[model samples]
Target: MVDGATTGLFLDAAGMKALGAAIAIAITGYASAIAEKDIGTAAIGAMAENEGLFGKGLILTVIPETIVIFGLVVALLINSA
Candidate 1:
């Protein structure tokens, strides 16, 4: 989008690289959130019925976070360039 004389984003090489990284991070966030949702509800429900399994259930619920960590690593790779 152009606002009169100013363009929305006139990205140079570095800016374009950053933009790509930002997009990758966003996608990673989405995937991680979805993954969490996939396992979290069931884990919580199971834990609610049986509190003894809290440790295992909690770890299982948070397992989705690994995707985000992988995404962070990818973002770091991009940022390093």
Candidate 2:
């Protein structure tokens, strides 16, 4: 009952779901990389300190992970819609 011309132009729910999943993963991964970059710099700065700063350094470095968490939530919402 499906037409050939319309077949290529249309995607089933499953296809759309897959696309959403892929986009979610990609966005999260990109955000994770950015977070890592921030952490690396904080770590380097901590290394130069003579007093206690390990905990501060770690916290400052990983703070960028919030971006990834938000990205994940957005992706989930989009997929559900």
Candidate 3:
């Protein structure tokens, strides 16, 4: 019974770590999506007003993607640990 309890506890800890990693990735991706949505809307408006602004708008739209990259790194670190 003691061994079973110990094994269960260990598995629980591992599960928690996996959950944490998943949450980190999910939250960051969600945040990035929200940010990108707003940015995309604004970019479209800007592009409609001034065709010359397309390059700048594209860069701005892509900036939010870094959030997901950082999240991925954090997830990797959590899993590794």
Candidate 4:
């Protein structure tokens, strides 16, 4: 076994804050990418069947990107504090 003092694998308050911010952004970005992928695939399929749906498909596909924007805001708040 190891001790905290000897191992020196601890995070101070600032480090913890940075880590939290990074985790928030990373997780949200990944989730948004996954959601966007599925939505984009569906949009493409719809657009293929009906050309008129191109505009709507594009808008729907981009909607998931809002998750990343929220994540960025959260990260900014975390770091600013």
Off by over 4 Å in 1: 1-9
Question: Candidate 3, residue 31: CA error in Å?
Answer: 0.7
Better model by lDDT: candidate 3 vs candidate 4: 3
Name the 10 consecutive residues with the lowest summed lDDT in model 4. Answer: 1-10
Segments of candidate 2 deviating more than 4 angstroms: 1-10
Ranking by lDDT: 3, 4, 1, 2
Compared with the true structure, what per-residue lDDT tens digits does model 1 show for residues 33-64?
A: 99888788888888889999889888998888
Estimate candidate 3's RMSD in Å.
2.8
Clashing pairs in 3: none
- In angstroms, the error of model 4 at 32 is 0.8
lDDT of 2: 0.74
lDDT of 4: 0.88
Write down the lDDT of every candidate, Cα atoms only: 0.81, 0.74, 0.90, 0.88
lDDT of 2 at 59: 77
Ranking by TM-score: 1, 4, 3, 2
The predictions' CA RMSDs to the true structure, in order, are 5.3, 3.3, 2.8, 4.7
For residues 4-45, could you state the per-residue lDDT of candidate 2 as single tens digits? Answer: 553444676656676877787688879888778978776877
| Error in Å for residue 56 of model 1 | 0.8
Question: Candidate 4 regions off by >4 Å?
Answer: 1-9
lDDT of 1 at 22: 87
| Residue 67, model 1: Cα distance from true site in angstroms | 0.9
Model 4, span 1-81: residue lDDT tens? 544553325776677788989999999999999999999999999988999999999999999899999999999999998
- Please give the TM-score that candidate 2 achieves against the real structure: 0.64
